[model samples]
Target: MSQFPPPLRQPEAERNPLPVPRPMSGRKVLLAVLAGLVLGWMIGMFMESIVANTPNDIDPDELHRLRWLLAAAGALSGLAIESIRQLQAASTDPAYRRRRRFRP
Candidate 1:
């Protein structure tokens, strides 16, 4: 027999490592939504400043409404991003993979 001992075997996790996706926690969701809303509101304000170069160019009340619209859009975007993340995580699951369809 040779002087060298048998080689050690790697554990199951090490042998076939699988990439795991972490679920978005509530805190992350809240932060994302808040960040989106704030950013959107800021953008709306910037746009308003640009459009309202002259006092009579844009109505003050309409600007307020515009801000709300932008904020809503931003919030929706945050939700969409989170949904995509969840979908990607689900797609990695064995069950989901089995049922998932491939595009031609």
Candidate 2:
């Protein structure tokens, strides 16, 4: 008796292909932005606290300003990073290359 059965090959239609990148949904986009904002806020608070003159703490007024400024900056950077990533993914796709090459 054979220890194992012969291996079976998958059909072309059933074979797995490389995953294609898709655009983020509205909810996913929101989550990405929110994650960036929170990350920036954390970093900003840490840096600000580190540089503070009195007892290593930031002033309340400065903290208020940092919240908005850092969050906005982070959101912009996050969106930009996502765009670059998407572009890279599209560039690597065969269909995208063909379409670009034969554009009218």
Candidate 3:
């Protein structure tokens, strides 16, 4: 019998061990949400001020709709920004790169 014991099994550290994402820090997520809300509020106030000063009168319903639209846009933009940051982090991480898509 060979003197050497079976080589100790080493865990492979190639790529993402699990596809499912683990929970991230809630504080960071909360901060992003708060920042988005503040930005949305500021945008709403700025739009109101602009509309109030405009020479042409806009329908009240239309003005309300515009405000809502702008707020929604702000939120979506913020989400997109956050997603991009997450993607960047994943791309740059060596562990993540192992699992990311490969070029042919």
Question: Whose lDDT is greatest here?
Answer: 1
lDDT of 1 at 9: 96
Task: Give the TM-score comparing model 1 with the true structure, all chains together.
Answer: 0.63
Query: Which 10-residue window in model 1 sums to the lowest lDDT?
Result: 90-99
By lDDT: ranked, best first = 1, 2, 3
Tens-digit per-residue lDDT, 1-104, candidate 2: 89999999998856856566666455655666788888888877776676674675556787768867887888877777776656666554666544455658
Give the lDDT of residue 11 in candidate 1.
Answer: 93
Cα-lDDT of candidate 2: 0.71
- Per-residue lDDT of candidate 3, residues 42-103 (tens digit): 78878888988989888878777777777777777776677666665555455754656779
lDDT (10s digit) by residue, model 1, range 10-91? 9997886555767657776677788889888998999888878865666789999999899889977887787776767746
Ranking by TM-score: 1, 3, 2
The Cα RMSD of model 2 versus the native structure comes to 9.8
TM-score-better candidate, 1 vs 3: 1
Name the better of 2 and 3 by lDDT. Answer: 2
Q: For each candidate, what TM-score against the reference?
A: 0.63, 0.50, 0.54
Which of candidates 1 and 2 is the stronger one according to lDDT?
1
